[model samples]
Target: MTPRRAPAERQRDPERTKAKILEAAKAEFGAKGYAAARVSDIADRAGVNKQLISYYFGGKEGLYNELTASGYRNNSAITDPATPLAEVLRQFVFVGPSDRDAARLFVWENLEDSDVGFDAQREFMQRQVEYMRARQAAGDFPDDLDPGFLLLALISTASAPFAFARVARAATGLDPTSPEFTEAYAEQMTRLVKQLAK
Candidate 1:
């Protein structure tokens, strides 16, 4: 007879399973928008049974929510209120290629406008508004400028490259992931902000 496994060993580890689902979901969703992405694709990427994806995450919507929610947590850390805006912007722009998938997922969600996608997009926008208000109150931004517009401008400068790769390539002649490009872009934005504030 086969030996019985301990209960701890036998029981499914939900955290590990959930993480696997999220990782797969990020890749699949990044490559294919929410409307086009398939649960079987995520399950295949994770090397898990399709039923496991449903069992752990409830469905594609749940998987997408988990990934986007986690992205917010990760991004919020880097943009913490205590961090200098310039430093935060620098890190935000130059944080390397690993974040490309997250960035892609963000762009895809914004383009699709599904319920789960919109929630993530709304949270990001709200955070940007709060950040802009804080910067304005601290005199880091122009007093005469609208905080909302300034925030939108800053976000555009930082994120446009990720969303519009062709434009970024044509104007900068540098890949979005290049260190030189990131540093140059960050410096340019910093100078612009300072000039505007003055």
Candidate 2:
């Protein structure tokens, strides 16, 4: 009798496969930045064929765009009006890997002076500025302060530890990415933000 052919690999789960590709892509983009990350490497990391990336994301640019959008989507709660501003600041400090990857991606964009996704970033920040303006009008803070600048300051303060890890560690003698540092810093940031609103 003829030898039986090997069974075909089980069918892939679309959502799970996409998630695996995204997670692997995030790591690759974060470590090497968009300019240097490769589709084949991400595929290898995800244990999927490289063509799956193109099939799912349409290619590297699409993967980068989706990664950027997902970062915002994952942390969209931080901007919810129902959340107190101080709590929002705290949440920003305690955000997970997606935000960290976004921060790294931002650094790479800055280093390369690329404007790949500035419009989307600008639109997001504009909404944030509008929210801050509304908060100022509601007497959450002094109306004399520019809402745009205030929002910028708050974001920078929340993101400083991640974006400036070396300086953060040097200044505080604590690893900026550590739970100890994040917890303490989140509380301090919340207090400071509350003071601003008062």
| Runs of candidate 1 exceeding 4 Å displacement | 1-12
| Candidate 2 local lDDT, residue 72 | 62
Return the TM-score for each candidate structure: 0.86, 0.86
Residue pairs with colliding backbones in model 2 are none
Residue 156 Cα positional deviation in candidate 1, in Å, after optimal superposition: 1.9
Clashes of each: 0, 0
User: 75-170, model 1: which lDDT tens digit per residue?
Assistant: 776766665566666676664354777778877887887688567667877887787778777777667888778766776667877888788889
The CA lDDT at 92 in model 2 is 76
Alpha carbon lDDT at 60, candidate 2: 87
Model 1, backbone clash pairs (residues 3+ apart or across chains), number: 0
Q: Which lDDT values do the candidates have, in the order given?
A: 0.77, 0.78
